[model samples]
Target: MSAGAAAIRVVVVDDHPTFRIGMSALLAATPGLEVVGQAASRAEAVGVVLGADPDVVIMDLDLGDGSGVDATRELLARRPEVAVLVVTMLDDEHAVYDAIRAGARGYVLKEAQPQEVERSIRSVAGGGLVLGAGVARRAMEGLAARADARPFPQLTDREREVLALLAQGLDNAAIARSLFVTTKTVRNYVYAIFTKLEVKDRAALVVLAREAGFGGDER
Candidate 1:
């Protein structure tokens, strides 16, 4: 926290003391970063996040007392500006979707290289979303399985198609091309998707899709 230091304040939340220590050391020694706090449990993690007001939170999705997903939700609800970057061993499709639902800005596997983790923190801090290598695939499969069953069941054909692509992580351009429509129309469809689904963002929509049966198949 110096003049033009380029530092990103971060907190490490993991149950394993050893991993926490290692991450703390790495973040402390890395350029443009400062390890502001550490937490070992769900409640502790929430407290540390709220108290420290760190720019980025490096968290494990599996905490001792509460799910890391819930912690992320609480942290974001309290301070939505604070970014949550999930750095955990849970890479399953459901786990990934759950993290997204909880409002994580990024996701990275614990097995990722140290630099990759740092990059993720920086990316989230700078307002860019990030995801681990295999997490996107998991999300996509999760989305596909969800498209089979309609969450709304009341959406028209176009709205359902747009929602399906939205759950696939497609922005307006991609959705437009896929549906042979203009970007403006795609944006309108996206608006309708959110309005009908009663979700706020793409992450939440994707989670709903999986819950609706979007992840049972890979293709």
Candidate 2:
């Protein structure tokens, strides 16, 4: 959906000038999104974010001044309303887990296609989290085996119910119908599950379910 005529305002922060420029152009042209500012270092990033007050911050993992993870934490602490989305080459679990802990709304590998990056921006801005495809699954498996932030957490009963449905490959609509709730309600549950379980998306949800010895029928 277009989600109304107002576009998603965003700032691109990366150490690489080329990456900052390329992402700025790509995101600006995407539907329902606009690149309001750009920065190539940690200091510049903070300036752009504070100056633009954008809805989303597309941040690189390695900036000129420091790791983007640091920036993510600081930004959230400073501006709790503004969201950070990590878009970089770092695929390490530490990076992914740290970013999430730092209050990142989404994590996209640099290898993710341009479309995926744009989709992530929208997803996070729309109150959802995006995890790298396999990351979610791996996190789940680790969770099933051990309660670790590797990056799963203590999933509550209701959250586990939601995750189970997600593992069955149910979309928000189907899950809502099965649970006799509204789609918006299901979306909220899914987001909570992601944060609590430390899984990123449906694919990871499934992997974690299997590793935990759960099936669609288990719920």
Candidate 3:
């Protein structure tokens, strides 16, 4: 951020009013950043970004009315040049990976210091991928846990679990019972797995899973 360089234009998108205000104020006071707009939901996020044309968007994972992941995906689809940085309370691997899959350029926990947030925004705005220290470690651990031996590595850990159960000839209800999730949730995971693996039918999916060394365990 040079003295004469343009300040990075930014939009703050969060469901929490206090958090949004605080973040906007911090960015407003920062030397090389400018707070251009604010939004509280997914629709507002897209509207504000479209209207403001900010260089960066600070997004939350949960919006009261809709998901920030969906918002990020929509925003990037319409404005591919705009950089998105997810600043959310969720630190789970699924949430983090989902945000990244939705095209977030950076992911940082809400607990990150103001300085860290500012640095991440600037880094993403400049075309760099940024992940908070804890987030980086968690992401690495998730990857290491699946390390090469796991089939369909693109699928999340939970998705892999569902696939393994499905390969074992368990129906959605059985999977739901085994995983302690609702049947609908298991169905959704199965759909996502099918789409990701490009398998058209259940039998084919099971065969593919078996060939890849999954579903061998009794569980």
Report clashes for each candidate as comma-separated counts.
8, 2, 0
Q: Against the hidden reference, what TM-scores do the models get?
A: 0.65, 0.63, 0.68
| Candidate 2 vs candidate 3, TM-score winner | 3
Cα misplacement distance, residue 144 of candidate 3 (Å): 2.1
User: How large is the C-alpha RMSD of every model relative to the true structure?
Assistant: 13.3, 15.1, 13.8
Query: Which candidate achieves the best TM-score against the true structure?
Result: 3
Query: RMSD in Å for candidate 2, one decimal?
Result: 15.1
Measured on C-alpha atoms, candidate 2 has an lDDT of: 0.82
Q: Write the per-residue lDDT of candidate 3 for residues 57-157, one digit (tens) a residue.
A: 99998898899999999999999999999999888788888998999999999999998999999899989999999899988888888696556779998
Residue 170 of candidate 3: its Cα lDDT?
A: 93
Candidate 2 segments exceeding 4 Å error: 1-4, 137-219
**What's the CA error at residue 133 for candidate 2, in Å?**
0.9
lDDT of 3: 0.92
lDDT of 1: 0.85
Please write out the lDDT profile of model 1 over residues 66-107, one tens digit for every residue: 899999998899999999999999878888878888889899
The numbered model that scores best in lDDT is: 3
Stretches > 4 Å off in candidate 3? 148-219
Counting only residues 3 or more apart in sequence or on different chains, how many pairs clash (N, Cα, C under 3 Å) in candidate 2?
2
